[model samples]
Every structure is written in C-alpha cells, then in structure tokens.
Target chain A: MDDATRVEVAASLLEAYRTRQPIEPLVEKYAGLELDDAYAIQQHQVQAWLGEGRVIQGHKVGLTSGAMQRQMGVDQPDYGVLRDDMFYPEDAPVPAGIFLAPRIEPEIAFVLSRDLTGPGVTVAEAAAAVDFVLPALEIIDSRIRDWKITILDTIADNASSGGVMLGSTPTRLSDVDLRLAGCNLYGNGALVATGAGGAVLGSPLLSLAWLANTVGRHGVTLRAGHVVLPGSVTPAQPVRPGDTWTAQFAGIGSVTARFGQETA
Target chain B: MAAHEAGHLLDPGATVGPIDLRTAYAVQAEGLALRLAAGERLVGWKIGYTSAAMRAQMRVDAPNFGPLTDRMLLAGGEPVSTALTQPRVEPEILLILGDDLPGGSDRDRVAHAVGEARGALEVVDSVWRDYRFRLEDNTADGSSAAHAVIGPLLPAGVDLAEVGVTLIGPDGERSEATGAAAFGHPLDALGWLADALAAQGSRLRAGDIVLTGGLTAAVPLPSGARIRADFAGAGEVSVRREAAVPPSRTPADTAETGT
Candidate 1:
C-alpha cells in the first residue's frame, strides 16, 4: 500500500467504527498490505483520534500464544495501541450494540509503575518495572466485517480492541506464579473455555518483555501508569446481546463483563 | 554509519556532512576509530567501481577503496545480519597476500604478493538517499561497504583476465561477467589499489585480504534472498539475507563472511 491508500483506508476504518458498521477486511481492498503499510495506516487513524481529543491509555500484544503464532504462520506477535475510551468500569453494563462483532478473552494485565524502555529488554528487566498484575477481560471487537481478518487487518484495526474490564485485585509479581495459574471462562452461566497462563508465551511476563522491545524500535515507551494486555490465555469466544462473561484465574482475581441486551 | 546499516536513509548527498576528499577520509577515520574503540581489528580492504561502465555511471575517474575490518566479514551462504539501505551484491575476486606489496611495485611483484585467489561476494549499502551523491560522499561512507562473503581459496595459478563469473539470484534470475570487467584484468585492480593506498602512505601487508572490483552490475538483495556466484576454476560463493522484518525494527547486527 502506498501513501494515498494508507490514508484512505485509515479514514474508512475510522468511519466504520463510528457508524457501528463494520467494513470489509482491509486486505481485500489493499491486497498488498505489508506490515509497514498496515502500521502506517494504524498510526494515521491513531493521530486522527488524538486530534479528536482521545487520550492514549496503553498498548496490546496479539498472537503471543504458540497456537496463534502457528495459526498465523508468524514467528513474532503483532501489537496495537489502546486509548482511554477503550476502558470500561467493571461494575457497569457494556452496550453490546457499540461493537460490531465483539469477542472475549482472558489476559494477565500489567499496570506499570516504572517505564519499560527497550529494544533489548529482558524478561527479568520487565519484571522489575511492574507495579501490579490484574485479571483482565479484553473485549475485542473488529471494525472488519464478521471478524474475518488477516494479521495485517487486525493490526491496522488496533488489534481488534474494543474495551477493557479489569478485576479489583492488584497482586504483585512475587505474590503469584502465573505460569501455573489456570483460568476458567464463563459465559451466561456456562463454561466457555479453559486455559493456563503458560499459554501466553510461557508466562505473561515474557509477552510484556516482547511488547516493550517490539515497540521500542518505533520509539514508544511503556510508561508508568500504562496498562498492557500481554495477550489472551485462551482463544477468543464470540459475544452476544444479553450475554455475561466472567474470567476466573486460579491464584489471581476474576473479572466480569455484563452486556446490555441492545443499545436503546 | 550504524543508523545507515540499519536501513535508515540519511540526507541525499554527503553522508559524513563533509565534501572534500580529505574530510571524507577524516570522516571515514572517525568511523574506523569507533570500530576500533569497539574492539574490531582491521583485516583487509575492498575496492569498488573498477568496471568501466560502473565508473562511467558514477562519473568517477578511478575506483574507490576502503578498509575492511573483522566486523565487516560474513561467511558464505549466511544471511545478512543487518538491515541495509538499498543493499546490493557485487561479485569479486579476493586476494590473500602472502607477502607485502611494496609501493610502486610492478605487475610482476604485485602478482607475486598474492598467496591465493577466491570468489567472493561483497554486500554494499549506501548511506545517502538513493545513492545520489559525489564520490567523496560514498568514499567517506566506507565505500558503501557492509560485508564480504568469501568462497573456497584456490592456489595462485587461477586464471585472471579470462575467468568467467556466473551470478544467480534467489528467484533464478541470472547475470554473467568475467574478471576482465575490472580494468581488463583483476590484477590491474589490485595494482591500482596499491597505488591508491600508497598515495595515502599506506602499503599492502602480508595476510591482508583485498577484494578486486565488482565483476558485474550489482543486484538488489531483498529479504530472504539467496545469491550464488560461480567463478570458473576458482570456486563458488553465495550469500543469503535473513527473513524480512518491518523496516527500522532490528537493532545492531554482527557476523557474516565465509572462508
């Protein structure tokens, strides 16, 4: 994709989000959306949103799990930025109609106390920067129609992030061995998926470390007071109106996301 | 230099921000000092643009040369370890000196100093945007040198002028040339190199490796490209570029060059 197409695609994706009308996968139109082109398109939209008075909240890592990596045939994971509007109160009901096709995943979220800067940060170094960890439910909604997306499509769509719901408990890294922590996800009073923390790059800390190094090349710093969702520990399951999803970690806390039947 | 090697395109003309050859050499010396500071040893030198057509295209009167350090060598078939701004490969005959070549030596003495000859590939990258610059700019940019990949060494008797070179690209594209492309004979390039260096009060030393000028037009080496160079009667050498990363993503890279 060239300069013109990047700007054009960014505008289309932004319009789709505001209109609650998901557009076709960008890959269909661009046909040759390279990693750099997709990143450029994503940044164009990010800048536009910032101009509209949106605040950047954090970042997200996607395809960290071996299964996702293998499925996508990519050796490393892709990333996206998160904004202040993406976070929602855990106690309030989220409007289902706001998202075109939302899905839910459990993640180990890191809230940083120290800025993590690196093009070469180690997992040990990342461990030193964390303030606390929380159970998080990432409500991934695609601006691309039907969630049919390639890696480029998802990356340009801000890693398909819609909203974030966090658990109340804030535990330190030393308090829990997340690699051994198992998670059970529930939806509408029924079990939907089960996974362990090891599913996300052996441990969520490794994902955090990778995220820092990956973005650091672009001059981005994972700053203090920022939230980082390493990746989903389990495959994302679809969302429906009136559905309620809760993710419970064995040693960590649990986060619940209640959805409205439909927007008025 | 580090930024340029990372595929960062700098200003269009002079890379070192200096225009004169003296300043160009000084700027090059500054970069060499940094390499030495980082514990790299000077191993050899590489000459570029020896072909008549190349010199004409670049509008230069003579071939340019620059120092080759241990850090700039790569093993044959090994992938290029760093991202480069406009990386291209040029095939050459490498001369490993068994004895020093004294200043103003005749072609006989120059030929005698060669211990052996080998087929080699030099991966060249430009620091200036689009390689649009004066010869001084490229000279200061270390003759646009990134890495050298060597092939199997052959005894001193390999044919010089008539030796044929066949280059195959990763996608099976082919380019053909011969040793005569460099000043009608590879040995003349070596002789010119000695005179060029002697002008700067530097003389060839024993164990010094010298890369004669490119045999054919350079070809672009994209991500995962594997380029093979076959030098008739000497040996064959090849190089591969690592799988693609988004531009400007990878950090400092070290190691590549074959025996």
Candidate 2:
C-alpha cells in the first residue's frame, strides 16, 4: 500500500476507535497491504493519539500462542502500543460500553527494570531487564467488523489492543518458571480454558526478546518503567455484558476483569 | 558554621552566584568531612529534584544528591525537633539495597540490588534564613538533610508508579499524589542517582537506604502537630513535633557570625 492509502486506512481505524464502530478489514480493502505499510498505518494512529496527549504507557505483543495464531490465521506475532487511559483496575468493574465486542486473554505482564535497546537483545538480556511479572488480562477488541482481521489488518488496528487489567501482586522472574507457569481462565464461576506459559513462543521471555529486537529495527528503545504484555497463554475468550473473568496463574497471582452491563 | 547556627540574617533575594554542580558537590564533600570528623556515620544518600512536584516547587531542572547519616535517622512516631529553622516534611519512597549497586546507567542493576521499597517522610530543615538559597547553596547545606521516618515496606516487585501517597497535614486537610509524580516512577530516580554517584566515583553499598526524592512539594512543620503520610499498598508513617519550643521563627540572628 502507498503512503496515502496507509493514512486513509489509519484514519478509518482511528474513527472506529473514536466512535466504537467497526469498519471493513484493511487487508480486503487495500489488497496490497504489506508488513511495512501495516506498521505505518499503526504508527499513524499512534502518533495521532500521542498528539491527543495520551501517553504511551507500554507495548503489548499479540498472537504469541499457537492457538491464537491459528485462530487469527496469522503465522507470526505482532505488537501494539498501550496508552495510560486503557488501564482498568482489578478491583473495579470496567464499563462494557467502552468496547465494541471485546475478548479477553491471559498473559504475563513484564514491568521493565531498565531501558532495553535492541538488535541483539537475547533471552538473558530480556530476563535481566524484567523487574517483575504480574498476572494480566488483556481485553483485545478489533475495529474490523465481525472480528474479521488478517495479520495485516490486525497490525493496522494496533494488534487489536484494548484495555488491560493487572493483578495487585507481583512475582519475581527468578521465583516463577515462565515455561511451567499454568493459568486457568474462569468466566462467571465456570472454567473456560487452561494454558501454560510455554505456549507463548516456548517461553514468554523469548516473546519479550522478539519484541525488543523487532522494534529495535525501527529505532525504538523499550524504556524503564514501561510494562510489556507478552502474548496470551490461551486463545481469546469472548466477553459479554455482566461477565466477570479471572486469570489465575499457578505461581503468579491472579487478576480479575468485570464487565458492567449498560442495558441500553 | 551552619552546624553551630541554624538560621542566618541576609537578603532573601541574594544568591551565592552561578556555582556549577561540580563546585556544589565539592563543597558538599567538605561539609560531609566535617560531619564525619564530628563522629557521625554515613548511612545512605538522598536524591533531590527527582520529581515534578519537587522540581516545580524548587524551580530546578535537574536532580541533585546529598549524603545521609545515622544521626539524621528517625524512627516512626518519634518527636521531631522544633529547633531546626523552617523545617518541612516530604513523602518519599526509600529503596533499601540488599547488594552493592554496580556502577553505570543500567536500571536493571538498581532494581536487582534493592531488596525492599519503603514509604517514609523526610524532614527537611533549611539552613539559610527563610529557606532561601541558590541550587548550589542548597547542595552545600546537605540538601537540608534532617531525619527520615521509615514507614512500611511494600511487597517485593510492587509497581512504584501506582504507590499512591496521601499526606495529612497538621491541620485536617490532606494532599494526595502518587509515585508517578516522582519522575514517572521512583526507580527512575534511583537509576539517575546511580549514574550521579558513578560520576562521583562512588556507589551505593549493601544495606544503604536510597531516598528517591519527594512525592509532593514540602509542607510546613508546626509545633505539636502530627503529620502522617499514607502510601498505598505500603502503609502509613507519622511524626509528631515537640510542643515545648517555638516553631522555627526567624528573629534577627542575635548571635550572627556573618553567615
């Protein structure tokens, strides 16, 4: 896709975010939307949000799990920028009206101890950079109508990012084995799904390393104090009005997300 | 000279004039030598101007550091002396290092060395009259080092950015802010302190207390008044002022020695 087309596609996605309305998939509309163009489209939206005074709190990696990739029909993982306003507390009920059909997934949130520069960021380097890990539920919502999104379309939609709910407790990297950490997804008093940390590109640390190196090519340095959400352990689960979901990790603490009913 | 006299008589507008940070730190070293000679043992270090609240109140652009000593440590619920000139209190996050901080700008080392994060209130007493001083002069006065009332320890690996602080004044009124007010996160300030100390050929040792600046601008300390700051997820810290003395009023320094 050309620069002009990317800008136009980004504008539509931004409009969707603003109005909470879905639009046609960009991949179908553009047909030639390559990886670079998809990222350019995402950057355009990120810049626009930054212009609106919303801070970049961190970044989130998506499709890290084989289940999610197979579900979304994407072969590789992608990332999205997280804004400060998108964080909801684990103690409170998040308003459902904020999203246009949201899906929640379980992941490990990495809060960095220092700024990480890329290109040669290894698993050990990634491990050292993580100050601690928190159990997190990432509410992934797409701007593409009917949840129809190819990798290019999803990338253009900021990797289908939405709000995030984090647990109050934090576990040290050395204390918990990320590969063996298990999570049980619960919705409304019922077990919905189960997964292990190894589902995320073998280990979540590898996903972190992948993110650091990929964004390093674009001159991005993941700064200290920033939170990075590695991909979900299990596939995404659909959310409904008055739905209460929890992601309970074996060694890590759990985080809850409650969707409030509007009834209008 | 400041140890012998707490207050001074001078023009409030007068500045020591254009002293760089290097000169200021050197002067600070001289002051530290005198304290050490007088039998005070160094305990920790304090970084100032690390928070937007602190920087906005102090009108300084960059952060500065000063040494803390055993004599300046105060336990929780202790009575603060009213003798210090124009004393004010600030809520701060103190990181207790379990290991020696390796030199350089890497924040990973700063986090690894810190065994615990605690909430505390730092009692800052000014030396020159009316708390008036240039940036360099403030440094030489030991960044107004007075006492630290250590409060509660937060859970390990807890996010410092969300550490909400509620400072209850001598009066019933309360001022609120969070750890993010301190340079987005307290650890960032610690990272800066690591680099600053490294430049000075020093490193934070194991068991050292590192105060990561104030979460809020300073509030006045009054006689018989109890001030408490509640840090979310950590706990609360309180200090009571001695009621027997006048609350640091600046009369003409009757015994002024040209300070």
**What does candidate 1's lDDT look like per residue over A1-264, in tens digits?**
679989999999999988988899888877788999988888999999899999998899898876677787787888888899889899999988898888999988999999999899999899999999999999998999988888899889888888899999999998876664556677886555555566677678999999999889999899999999999877889988888999877557789999999852
- Residue-wise C-alpha lDDT for candidate 1, range B98-150, written one tens digit per residue: 99886788899988998888889998887877776677888888888888898
> How close to the true structure is residue A218 of candidate 2, measured as C-alpha lDDT?
98
Evaluate model 2: give its lDDT: 0.81
Sum up the clashes in candidate 1. Answer: 7
The RMSD of every model to the true structure, in order and in angstroms, is 23.8, 20.1
lDDT of 2 by residue, B102-169 (tens): 56747677778888899899998866666667677788777877788899987676667555566778
Kindly give the stretch of ten consecutive residues in candidate 2 chain B with the minimal lDDT sum.
B3-12
After superposing candidate 1 on the true structure, give the runs of residues whose Cα lies further than 4 Å from its correct spot.
Answer: B1-259
What is the lDDT, from 0 to 100, of the residue B4 in candidate 2? 26
